[model samples]
Target chain A: MTFKLFSEHLLIVVAAEVLALAVGLPLGVLCYFSPKARKPILWVVDVLQTIPALALLGIIMVLAGAGKQTVIIGIALYSLLPIVQNTNLGLLQVDPGVKEAACGMGMGRMYRLIHVEFPLAFPVVFTGVRIAAVNAVGSAVFAAFVGGGGIGTAIYKAIRIQNMNMLMQGTATLMAIAIALDLSMGWVEARIKRGHSSMKKAPARRN
Target chain B: MIKFEHVSKKFGKKQVLDDMNFEIPDGQFVVLIGLSGCGKTTTLKMINRLIEPDEGRIYIDGKDIEKVDKVELRRQIGYVIQQIGLFPNMTVAENICVVPKLLKYDKESRDRIVHEMLDMVNMPYDEYAHKYPSEMSGGQQQRIGVLRAFAASPPIVLMDEPFGALDPMTRETLQDEIKKLQKKLNKTIVFVTHDMGEALKLADTIIFMEDGKIVQMAPPETMLENPANDNIRRFLGKHMNDDAVTLTVEDFMRTNIITVDKHRGVRECTERMARTGVDTLLVVDESDKYIGTVSIKDIRLRGKNEKLIEALITDNAKTVRRDGDAHECFDHLLNSGDNYVVVLNNDDTIAGIVTKNSMAKALSDTLWGDER
Candidate 1:
């Protein structure tokens, strides 16, 4: 039962994060490139993030009916801010000289974005994704309140039966998973940073 | 060949470049020198269409630059900036091969050309081909910036203070290397610098700019000798001493001399020295060639009965070439950790001595003369 609960919990959070990234990254990149569209899009996202998390979940639960779909939608909305903000920040922060040099070398816009801008912006964007992922995993446990199914169900059961051990076990496992995910992401971030510094150093060595 | 005809550029209400007209002959090294905000950099960018002119046109080779596709035009010409602007994410080899890769050169050819360019820039292929920009010093980064510009072997190169960020020693060395490379490559070069000395050293012709206008365009020698107006004269003030400062060892050489042979006694040497009243005497070999110098103190330190030849000591004295200028002389004095240097002739013979006092006097004379 515990394994089933853990797997289900992991799957829902992963799905939510993946969905959020898919929607948010392109939006962020678009906002970065199109000066005209950025302000309006950012305003709308800002308003969306202002909604209380429980209020948003309760609103979605009423509108979509309680289940995995309702919880996923709620978590994905809550996860959008970090991913979008990060993607925009990352792309905008790319060195203008590097972009110009790339273009001056005859790289088209698409090629420059993929080869130059994206790699330079990767670490910053990854940071955003890390924040969003942790947030999504924590929020997924709350889905048990709407009958979405996960370790949250055990916590709910223990609460109704006045069983502290079951409650502690459920909460402890979620914390462990969150910590493990954070550590792994940190490892990946360091690897990305090392690769970036190495790339940054290449032209300097030639001189 | 590149020509700017009645070119003017304005940003909003402010005019940055005003009716500037100049022509650079094919295969010529033309340097633009002026103070900061002089539009020298703007002029370089205009040629590549990085900054558009408000009025008039720029011609490259024969056609109007505006008519040519900008990307294609830029790809055909090499552009270097002080910041280097090498793609930070690319390897040294990749940075060198950027344009070729853009032009769709095959992988094998690109790799070969990258290696060749690294060699051309004096960064050997084996040591630097795979290295990154961050591992190198400012000087190395600047050299790669130059190589990156020439990697595609463009017929023209535009440099905007390319070595400006380097230390003085590195800057001068790079300047010399680039001059040699320019002669060998014979590419049409448009170099922009704020340093008048750099322009004097490198330019075949100089364009003196002020507030985006070309005040004068002439050979460096002509510009130095005859500035057109007060503005032109003041612009070239720093470089006025360049000629006098660059004297070679040959210039200060004095051949006629009083000398003594190794067999001479201290009493006999003293008589010759008394007649000349010189502090030191040049000792000659049997062939009347230069051997060493003997001082009165050296003879006095030895007993009169001792053989003067055996008593005389030889010291390796510092020498400068006759062709060296005051700048070179000053550098030698500073580097030698000594008070004076003997200037030498082209034949490697003693010319004359340049004491610290002479160098100081020459510099002051030039400075005072320039003030008037």
Candidate 2:
């Protein structure tokens, strides 16, 4: 029964994160190219972050009605800040010398953006996604507030009936899931960092 | 061939390229040099149309650059930047083949070019081909950066202070390598730099710019001999090598001296020394190219009627070319404390020797010619 509850929680987190990444990536890239759009888009996402996660889900429930869709949409909206900010930051932070070199080599703008700029920026951008994923796992427990089943159901029930045994079981399982998600993402981050360092020859020597 | 006619460009209020007009002919190694922000780099960018002119036009091979596609134009011309920015993600071979791959060359040809370019710089393909940029030292990476530009075998190449980041020793080695490669490839190269030493060493023609205008465009030796104005004189600096007075090995070399075969007997060598009234006899092989020298003192000490002249040869021969810069040869002669230095033709055959007598003759000729 505890295993089933953790799996439901994992599914909700994964669903919300995938949705956030898909929507946030293009929006971030758009902000990257069009500075005019960047300010307003980032402002809206900032406002979204300020709202309490439960309040934001409650507000989302008014439109979509309470269910897994409401929970998924709330978690995804909350995850947008990190994904968008990182995507823009990563794109902007690519070494200017590398960009100049690509231009001098006769690479067209589109080709350079896709092949050169994006790949160089991928690791920094991925960091944002990792942060969002970990945050989503923590927030997904709120799904039980709207009757979207997960480990939150077990915890809320244990608390109401005053059963310390069930409360510890649910709490312990949630911590384990968070640790597992954090550790796995950390491993992915390490892999990207390794690839990043190996890709460059030593920094150019200066006179 | 590149011709820029009355081109002008302004960045904000500053005129970066002003009425730049010149023609660089085919297969010439031209160097553009000036202070920072003086538009030497701007002129190079105009050729590839990276920075379009505000007015006038540029022509490449009788065709207007404005009419050609920018991507197509750049693909045909090679470019190198000051930073030697080799992509870290790529292997040495992959970086070199970027251009050729873009041009849609077959796999075999691209691979062959990768090996050929690496071999030109003494970097073996088996060792360097698969190594990442991060795996190599800065000098090695810059060498590959240079080789990448030459990979596609473009007709023209432009370099903007490509070796500027390297130490003096590495910069010099790369400079020599570039000179050799340019000669071997016969490609027209336009290199930009702030370094006067590099300009003098590599350029067939040096275009000196100031205030977004070319102050003078002349060969290195000519520019050194005659600066067009005070600004040019100041810009050339007070480098010890170049001055108003020109001197070469040809100006102080003696053609009349003893010549003897290595097979010739010591008695014959001694006779030639006496006949020429000289202390030394140049010994030559069958090719008539100098191999060593025999001295009167040596002949006296080891003289034998049956022994060949080669036996007395001390292997003390030192050679300098007729067209070699005089100051360097003069210092070599002074430091060695030797009275004679063999002057050789380009083919390495002995032309004559530069000795104290020849220096005296040169002094006399300059003195007498001026008075007359």
Candidate 3:
């Protein structure tokens, strides 16, 4: 029974993360480029984040007719704020001199963004994505209350029947996953930062 | 050739650049000189479209710059700034070849051009090409900035106080190197400097700016000799004092002084000296090597048959070089404990004479009014 619950929980968390990234990245880039669209969109996302996780589950379940889909939607919305804000902040903070130099050298808008601005802004944006992922992992457990499936269900079951052993295993596994993800994301962020710093250190060779 | 046609730019309500018009001819080193907030930098930026003028147009090679593709246009015209603005991410060689690479120059061609530019700027390719901007001194970085601007051998280059951040000695050395390079390359260069001396030394023509308007534009000598207005006169402020003292040697040197060989007759030397109404004459060989000097009194006392040039002449007379300063001549006369001094040229030829009276007159002329 514990094995079944663990497998189900793992699958649900993975699926939720993938969904959030797929939807969030493009939205973040859009918000970063479009100044007019950013404030209103971010305001809506901020308000969504204020909704209690459990109530969000309840509200989503009623609208989407319950189960895993409803919980995933709720968690994804909750994760949007950090990712959007950080992406926008990171791109905006890229050195204007670099951008101007690129432009002066006849680099088109697309090329400048891809080669100069995007690479430079990657680390900060990655931090945002990592935060969002961690938030998603923690929030996935709440989905189990609505029968959305995951370790949260095991914990809920343990609570219903007063099973401390089952509760410890589910809670422990969830903590392990979160810690491992956080550390790996941190490692990836560090690698990107090092790459950027080294590139800066390298003399700009012509041709 | 570049021409600014009645250009005016304003940032909000503050007019940073008033209606300005100027034409820079091809292959000329034109320097714009002014104080801070004089809009020289703004004028430079407008050429590359980094700052667009609110009114009027700029033409490059007789076509409106606004009509050209800005990115391509900028790639062809090089720019160097006071802060350098070298891409910290790029190596020295890479920084130098940025425009060429952008223009799609092949790897071999780009490498060759980068090396040539580095060499031209006095930073040899091997030692500096692989180094980053942060690893170099301010002067070296500034040199790299200049090399980068010339990397593609652009016909036109604009520099905004490129050496302004360097130490005085480095600035002077770099300024000389830049002048040499510009002479060799013959590029149309617009060099911006706040330092009047630098402008005077480098500019083929100077544009003096005030309140975003060009107050006067003329060659350095003309500007120094006859400033356009009172403001310009005040701005130039006693440039004659700053004129190198070496130039005053010509004015103070005595042209009527005579010289004789060591074997010359006293009577003949005295006759020549008396006819010239001078007491002293420098003794020299046929080749004009300065041997010594003879006085009229020496000739009168010593026998006429005796060699007055050698027997009674002062062999240890004080002397100055032809290029020596008028001030130095005055100092020598006052402190030498002698009435006169001989002046020699580089070849040891007798150039002229400096006496106590002449030194005093030169000093007084420099110090007092020219009422006489």
Best by lDDT: 2
Q: lDDT of all predictions, in order shown? A: 0.80, 0.86, 0.80
Q: What's the fnat for candidate 3, on a 0 to 1 scale?
A: 0.21
lDDT of 2 by residue, A1-207 (tens): 377788888889989989999999988898898999999999999999999988998989999998888999999999999999999998897777677767777878777788778887888888998899888877888999997888888998999999999999888888888888889988998898798878753556564
| Per-residue C-alpha lDDT of model 1 across residues B202-259, encoded as one tens digit per residue | 9999999889888889988678777877777776786664452334444333455666
* Model 3 chain B: ten consecutive residues of lowest lDDT: B240-249
- Scored against the true structure, residue B63 in model 1 reaches a CA lDDT of 93
| lDDT score of residue B191 within candidate 2 | 98
Q: What is the lDDT of residue B34 in candidate 2?
A: 90
Best by DockQ: 2
Clashing pairs in 2: A199-B88, A200-B134, A201-B133, A201-B134
Better of 1 and 3 by TM-score: 1
- As a whole number from 0 to 100, the lDDT of residue A185 in candidate 2 is 85
TM-score against truth, every candidate: 0.76, 0.84, 0.73
lDDT score, residue B336, model 1? 80
Stretches of candidate 2 exceeding 4 Å from the true structure: A201-204, B240-243, B254-256, B259-266, B273-352, B355-372
Docking class of 1: acceptable
